[model samples]
Target: MTRKKYSKEFKLDAIALVLEQGYSRSEAARSLDINANMLGRWIKEHQAQDDQAFRGNGKLTEEQAEIRKLKEQVRRLEMEKEILKKATVFFAKETK
Candidate 1:
């Protein structure tokens, strides 16, 4: 069977049925014709992302993208700093 893809809005509405409408996960899943575990996973993803939930493939939420960029920058800076420190030590020994 081909895997089904759910739209972000559909996932959000399903989550709301459980969260805002106070339906149990199983009930919501049954009503939506989805697995209870799938509904639960959707709820977890929705809670983790809030408005950013269910961004499509190859996309990162703004906060997550910024964090990844910052981490890369930090790693680059740290490597540069390490190289400079080694260069300084090498020069000092050469000057001795």
Candidate 2:
């Protein structure tokens, strides 16, 4: 079965039920029809990340985006280096 995707706002609301509304984790999860363990994890994430919590798909933080771009650039540079190495070997053979 495909996993269900929760929106960031939904997650925040769920977290609020526990923090602001004083609902126990199990009670919140049961009332919301979600797993208690999942609710616990969401609470932890909310505590740690605050505003940055529950970033949905394709929405990366600035640091993560920069890292992704740098990794792509490194891969492209490595491929170019390999092509240049092959070209150098080809020219050296032709000169002999």
lDDT of each: 0.91, 0.96
Which one is best on lDDT?
A: 2
- TM-score per model over all chains: 0.61, 0.88
- List ranges where model 1 is wrong by over 4 Å: 63-96
Q: What are the clash counts of all predictions, listed in order?
A: 0, 0
User: What TM-score does structure 1 among the candidates reach?
Assistant: 0.61
Give candidate 1's whole-model lDDT. Answer: 0.91
Q: Which parts of model 2 have CA positions greater than 4 angstroms off? A: none
Report how far residue 10 has shifted in candidate 2, in Å. 0.9
lDDT of 2 by residue, 1-96 (tens): 999999988999999999999999999999999999999999999999988889888999999999999999999999999999999999999999
- Backbone clash pairs for candidate 2 read none
